[model samples]
Target: MPPRTIKAAIQDALEDLPEKKLDKFRSALLDRREEPRVKMNSVEGKDYITIAQVLVSTFTEPRALRITLELLREIGCSEEAERLGELPHEPKRISVISISQSIFAHGPSAGASAGRYMSGDKHFVDKHRTALIQRVSTVPSLLDELLGRGVIKQEGYNTIMRTNQEKMKELYAGPLNACGPDEKDTFYHILNQLEPYLILELKSTK
Candidate 1:
């Protein structure tokens, strides 16, 4: 496997702790009533890595790490959160902010969870890759639109049609990772139309 990125390194630290502490970490993450509220949940009995992956998917690396640190400190793991916080930087990428995205800005829990750390930057398709993979179906209609918009060609459309996992792989490898901002924006728009509730749910979580 490739070397773990800093974000993974920070999250994976939960693996070294006792199951009890990991439970607290997971609880802290799920308390939608709290600060740094991220809209996410891990199935009961999921492993630490699974919980960590869930966290990563719910926020950008910087925000994810920040929330992780605060939760760790809350659960009396300040030293660990501190150490993880020292990791240098996230690989820089250009962020495309558009006015059309404002549609998903308002969340259901805006009254309880609206805080400084609430995610505004995590709406785009690229930022929430794992969440989409986990929640969205094959979405052949979405694939059709992607093809119609030239975001994916015949071959990519066929490959991605196999399963959500395959679709996410193809999209990340071929489009979200390889294409420019315009294509990515198109993908996000298509996703919002197809999975409006899920998209809104995720956008509000951060």
Candidate 2:
């Protein structure tokens, strides 16, 4: 019998994943393929590496390794991809605290500092309500950047924005009726959910 191709092997491995996760992998893989290739000698290549490293860190080790292999294959690095596939598959245990620590370790310039601020030692929204509102207002721009970079599909982008709009409407019933603490808290919770997407957008932009 002939050995399976790299794609076939990947598909076989993905069969164990839930439909939702499988869909995400498929979409990300397709999007990566559609992106223009960055030459290794170009300045863009360094930026791409930085973005890719940050993006992959968001996933479990197994998923990250699989995606890295897929990306290598997409970029015509079949030999490296094959070698990566042969490595031991050990999933790293990640937590919100650990992720926040990693971001903070990079210092303020990493742009990931915002994430640490939001998740770290204190709740920025609770402590600085006015500033939080200002940051929330920038969600639209972040969504635009995410869509432009193909980090999110049009459908996903529309869904997330629409949901955010609905949340905002509820949080801001009227100019006279200011959002109560509870409402503001709920909005902050939604922002936390969207933080990973925002982080990916930031990494790509840098």
Candidate 3:
């Protein structure tokens, strides 16, 4: 027999799950498919450039721009980062969490646009949920370090960490509480927003 496609495998597996779990899985799959697709080539390059322009124009503050650039780089948008870097600095206007959400929602990702369906294995879902929880649990310490290093002032650090906490709450209440296809992209974006700052902190310590 020929190898099964990922969607076929997921459909077969869903038959064995309980009704409630199956409903969640189905809903998640639908949401994932509904998301906008980007081609990631020259045609889509203009769209990404427009997004970069919005980020640069929307976030005028130095610190906000730096964090946004870090997130763009984290999510594999080097061109966007470079574009933001070239813009003239302006005053602060938006919150870190707002910028994070904008990038998570609008920014392009290879995995996001690949049109791949997630596995329906219970163990796989549980494993990813646990990992995301652990990663989110470290935000406090990470924010403290950023504050100590003067990378962000106390007010900014508090604001960003508060945003992180709210996201953690949502994750636990929704995706982590019950794994769904939509959760994978949501969790990955959260990590993308934080990982760069954590990496920078590590480098500063060395």
Return the top candidate by TM-score: 1
lDDT tens digits, residue span 128-195, model 1: 77777755642666777767666678864446255666777766776557765545555666666555
Give model 2's TM-score versus the native structure.
Answer: 0.23
Q: Model 3 residue 125 lDDT?
A: 26
Residue clash pairs of candidate 2: none
lDDT scores for all predictions? 0.60, 0.40, 0.39
- Over the stretch 72-173, how does candidate 3's per-residue lDDT look in tens digits? 444444554555444433222333344335434554343345422233544222434443443343456444433443333454222432455564454455
Candidate 2 per-residue C-alpha lDDT over 1-206 given as tens digits, one digit per residue, 9 for 90 to 100: 66554344444444444455444444444455223432333322233334344334444334445455545554555565555466344222234333333334553343343433443443444444333343343356434533443333454323343544443343333320343323233333344443433323332331
Q: TM per model? A: 0.40, 0.23, 0.23
lDDT of 3 at 65: 43
When 1 and 3 are scored with lDDT, the better candidate is 1
Show model 2 residue runs off by greater than 4 Å.
1-47, 50-177, 196-206
For model 3, give the 10-residue run with minimal summed lDDT: 29-38
Arrange candidates, best TM-score first.
1, 3, 2
